[model samples]
Target: MSNIKEDQANFTNGFYLETHKRWEKFSNWIHCICVVTFDLELGQALESIYPPHVTLTKQETLNICYLAFPDSNSGCMGDTNFIVRLQSCPSKAVLSNVHTAYNSKCPPALQINPAYYWGYVYFRQVKDIKLPRGYFQKSVVILSRLPFNNLFTKIISVIAPEYFDNGNLSLEAACYNIDQWPTPVPGLTLSLPLLGSVFQTFIPHQRNSTSLILQLAGLNEVATSSENQIQASVEDLNLFDIFQPVLSHIDMLWELVITAEPLIVMASSPNHCSLMVLALTRIISPLKFCADHRTYFTIHDSDFKQFTNKVHGTPPVILGVTNPFFAKTLHHWPHTVRLGEDYGQYQKYKLKKNGNSKIFDSTPGVYSSYKPFLQKDKTMIKNLISGINTKRPFEVQSALLKKHLLELTHSFMIPLERYIASLMPLLKNISPFRAAPTPLPFNPDDFFAMLETAGPQLTTGIKGDWVGLYKKFFRSPNFNGWFNNRYTELALKLQALQLQALSDADLKLWVQGKPEVEIVDMVLKIKNKIKKCEQHDIPVSHTIKEQLEQRLQDIISSLPDDLKNILQTS
Candidate 1:
């Protein structure tokens, strides 16, 4: 009788799970949340895998733990958060479409197209005296392709600390809340509530914003940021803490970032490694860095063979590694930054090249350094030192450094931005008949010549051979990305101008002398114009689209009875 009852209970439980468990899948922006904790007998181990049904290979779990934990002298030293950017070979289902509030009654879209999953992992750790070793070390990792570190970290920031004291209940609740969020469509800023706190994320409609920022809405705040306001990121990238140690060498580093040089940053721990990598990637603002960079990388990652092959040398990857093994392997690379403990020290890098292999027994300090085009402000350095001596809050000290860097980057970019504007054709050249007016040619010679007359050195407050700097920069990936974006933006603007003019003019006037075939072709072009504007998310395009669409129908209606059938076919 007991056996029969047990079988009956099992059947009921299985039936409910099969029908009602769809809601328990991973979050939309998040792939999976995992708990990697220290096991007494097994050492580092994965304590729990969320969703209860997901399976991970033994090797994958081991690597997750290795990446989740920081390699420092004092293990589980303090509560901290850092990203672990890894290349993973996940199962097909793991990389499925983003989860929504799953409805069992509703069939999912028949297509099961698997998107490539890039692991944007959030690692958090804490300690508890009540645990086995007086140190409760664990990492809560969320795997996803979205590089919205500022957003996801905030969620894990709450979830991890709570889970350390409480248990899986908080984690489950947060996951449930995230799973219910809207599809995160572009141009929408959704106010997501997780465990009583409100967070905001702006899925930008266009490429106007360079980064994704998650804002935590304070309940007692007098007001919230208006939805229209687009702030790049609420959290400062990596804080000012990383820049203080290498204040003197900052100018050279900025040059390296802009030039897209392959550099390695080896630090004592994962926190410093990841933080420094993030900070370096953002030094040049307005002009986004185009090179590949890893925030935190380990030897056990799937990309290990790709990154470490001696025959290939090193690709142009700005890597942040904690393993000392990279010292020998990557010695052949162009530049290597050796960061001291707590990021307290840094050294200039130089390369002694012999067919791009480590030919000489030299310390990692041999990269070609460039002098700053703009003079360094000694006063700020003095103030920073004074702050450190007087025990100023890290926030205050960091802000000062960030301000200086921001100013420095802007000064460098002003000359470029000004020169780029001069490349645009005059407004009088634009016409309604053309699909889009092209910008004037980007002649390197003309630009260099204009720099002198443009008062570039004076306008930018950057002294030196401005021409030489431009020559070097124009060849770089950083400059390429900026130049492309500038031209593309200008082109889109021209397209919009043409559409705007078309909206005002009578379509019948333009089509009077045109053939039916020509009119049909014109209609197709107009359709494409609307689609392009929609893709680019031009605010005025919607109005113009309706106008063009209506005018097309009117032209068709006015056509003679014979051509009307042909127009209808079109």
Candidate 2:
């Protein structure tokens, strides 16, 4: 045990030592360039807000004054000087503590009078030890009055200047009153202990492919959770509820980044802002589904007078057509057109029983109810089947279903997308790209895996064969009684399989290696075979039929006793 402990301690010490050495090497190579310098006026303004006494350390104070307002020959000024002042401040601990408080169960009070805020302070360092080659390192500090009116508003003015047209100086003034200062300044120095380390270590280290990849993977995990949560919540929300919290959260996250580094606002290019807005809009857009079913009905009078004009021989009554899954709210049309002329004598008899009839019945002997009623029902069914068959031939059905499902998946992905978009301005200024581009269209493998894992209710007996059912339901033209019956059975089985997959691992194993063929293709092939069989019109030999029946019986008998009973019963 002692040896083990010693070994562990030695390993940890060695690891940290290596890490420290790597950091030192990296830092040594960093050519601390003064990219921007503020004049003494700006330095005085900054000091007035923070006071020279509230600095990271004596060295940091000197660094801020010297680097921020360096004498001539110092290349640093403007944006760079501001960033340096922020970097030199002892505000990390304060900022971090504030962040913690904001996130805590009981948030601490951070009073900032928006009107008193001056401009921001920023500092930059270049990571090129070698002459003439390096990326810039930046830090930003916002100098504002305590007790902010709206935190996000302040951040937008200080960090995201491209969002509005006001000049940086004017925006700063508008964001806060420059004159008001608390008589006794709130004695608070909130800090984030790991803020500097995060910037120095995590951000820069992630410049390499390996670290960046890991960071991206972590982000994906976060995105997945956020997306799923948002999608699951969308159906339960009203329109107002949907955008409000989402927009608010986005605003908050943007502000957090801005407050951390004010230069992030100024450094943001217009293109970056536009891209961020576009990405955000795409992420938040609602998913829409089109309804496809259409229903047409008609009513006729005994006098052969049509209430509505006839198409061919049939009078149209109700025509309810839709795209698919998209349902509209109902609208009522109460007034009847051509009311008195259309009713048959017998039809008028029914109406008179309920209330005093105003119009007299006419053409009492002309109507035959039975034949026409039956014919209309038969025609309705035939028309429905014809419509279904007509639609089946077009590739639109499959495309539409796929499109809708993809939309659903995209909807599920929105929250994560929004979160990432919110981070874009900071990401763009700090890195090469803002955020990951919208993901490519849904992949079959990933989709199937998601269905299996997240949608166990979708599983069926024929694992791969379920794809055929999907095609048939979505793509088939004639959904006749026979087809409907078969389809319903298969759907139920699929649903059962999905449920079993969710809760019963053993059942999931049973349907492995199922085929995934298009159902429409299978149906067409079957139809062709049936047509060929009918054309020949030859009865199967008794011997062949007997053999097939025997084989089927044998297969059924071979099932386990319990399963056999269940199958037989079902």
Candidate 3:
């Protein structure tokens, strides 16, 4: 049977109203999310089949990811992206987009043709948590579950579907971030790895549409991000602020794809790579970690799992209490106990302080239980979590990840540069006088006419971005002079052949032996060329005509003195 479950987040049984109201209380605006990706690598064999765009940066792909469950649909999920600078244009310096899945159906318009700002998104296969459907039935909680395979397929399909096809999706989540926090603390945190997908759909602006298309074409692999941890705490203790960092970990996912057929053709036409950078931002999950000590931590599913294990040994003694004293004693005491809700679950308990115990109302909202660990262990765990969550200490972890990403980017560029260097020789040795399969009678007028029609195509071969490549090649200090020299040699040879053929045809020598049928075929081909030129906005062919004639005259003058004098006399 298919494991796919109907998305519960889509309001079906009036459940959406309940969940929406819950998050509404904590909702904060003005969210800022950033994605930085570098060190992009393409398959060596694939590069030969479909060459990478040389006009843009190579190390420009990376992944970002986050976790999700019952409460949040567009919650913090992991995402992957590539960061690059435009070659010629200024102003917009970067391009960033995040990929994520949602339980609710998108708008009808967005499903087929998503808005330009929506970035790129695809439908993710989903399933229900079979047991959890009953577990939280007594309470207002609902936990949704979907397998990693479904998530992985959706992610890779958005990127280059042809290469990463049928990839195995494997992911594991631990109760705690082993690297940062080895032991269990009073608070909860989760560590999970997320799959990265490509964002291919982009708005059709002249600047970004072309470069983005080419960049995504060569992109095959989906980026898998490093494990990110989300920490949640509910401590009323003032001493906690001194020990822990301000934030535990910020999980953000960004996915974007560039798609525009017409723009791709236009931007890549000229010698200059129509290079422009674009930066766009969308709020995946906007959560502001409280900078003050009064802030309470909220745990997600991943973190709750770890918290469950730490208290698994100790049974919770459920008690009904309305007084602050009951909760205070529970806080001061040890052993896992639940006052109202279960421990290690995504429940935020309100800590209200009051001095009078006689007026203490016996309500189940306050939890009391025996402590699980020794006093020393408890202190250590609390201090470690606190220190990591602090602003300065958390930044250290973020910085380390950033540095690692940059190193990967540098490594990717080395092989890419080598590949481009290898192509220099082939580009230089292009033969201008190479004969076609069918040789037609030589006519200078026809040659010039074809040149006028195929102005850009004559220099740019099929499947090659020659003009963009040439501009980029000239900027390279190592190959600039050599490329110019080889290009000059090829241009001059082609010009000479055209001029010589024209001179011979005028003198009635070049086609003297050719039959009348051959001449007619050449005339037909020339007419078709002219027709094609009229179809589009033709560049100034007259300018090229003048240059061709001037070059022909210069070549004749440079000829040997005896030949030149004979030609002049004739």
Q: Which candidate is the best by lDDT?
A: 1
What stretches of model 1 exceed 4 Å from their correct place? 1-28, 37-66, 71-80, 87-138, 146-151, 164-169, 182-191, 196-234, 310-313, 344-375, 386-393, 536-539, 562-570
Candidate 1 clash figure, as a count: 7
Put down candidate 3 lDDT per residue, 1-570, tens digits, no spaces: 011112121213333345433222111100111111111242111111001111212311111111101113222122211111111112213221211111112211111111111111111213326543222110000011111112222332332222223211110000001112211111112222222211221111122222222222222222333233211111111112211111111010010100000000001111011111110111010110001100011122122232224344311211112223333333322211122312222232332232233134333222222111111223333444444556344334333333322232223223323333333333223332232112122333443344344433433222233233323323433133233433443444443444333323332232346564554444333333334334321222654445444433444454457755654454
Off by over 4 Å in 3: 1-407, 420-429, 433-570
TM-score-sorted candidate list, best first: 1, 3, 2
Indicate the residue-level lDDT of 11 in model 1: 34
Candidate 1 lDDT score relative to the true structure: 0.62
Identify the leading candidate in terms of TM-score. Answer: 1
Worst 10 residues of 3 by lDDT: 257-266
Worst 10 residues of 1 by lDDT: 103-112
The per-model lDDT (C-alpha) reads 0.62, 0.25, 0.23
lDDT of 2 by residue, 1-570 (tens): 233244334434443455433223212111121112233344311232111112235543333344333222224322332211122233432422322222221111122111122223344444536533343333334433222212212232233232122223232232122111112112221111110111011111111222212221122212233211221110011211111122212222221111111101101121111122222222222211111111111111121133222344322122221111111111111111111222211121111111112123221111111111001123322433343457542233322222322343333333323332232222222211111122133233444445444432332221223333322323322223223433343333333232222222232232334332332232233333334333432233444334433433343344557655654454
Could you give candidate 1's per-residue lDDT for residues 1-570 as a string of tens digits?
233244334434543465334433334556677888778898768888655556666766777777777764425366767776654554544433332212111111111113333333444444567887876677778765555556666777776776666677666666655655666454455666656566765543334332222121111212355544223332345445677666666766777787777888877677677778877876765456776677777776667788878697767678988777776777667676666654543332343332234333334433433454445556767777788778887766765666566666666677677877877777777776775678876788877676666645563454565566667788877777678867877777777777888777788887888887877777777767777766655546467788977876767766788877876675
Residue 195 accuracy (lDDT) in model 3: 25
Q: With candidate 1 superimposed using the best TM-score fit, by how many Å does residue 391's alpha carbon deviate from the native?
A: 5.2
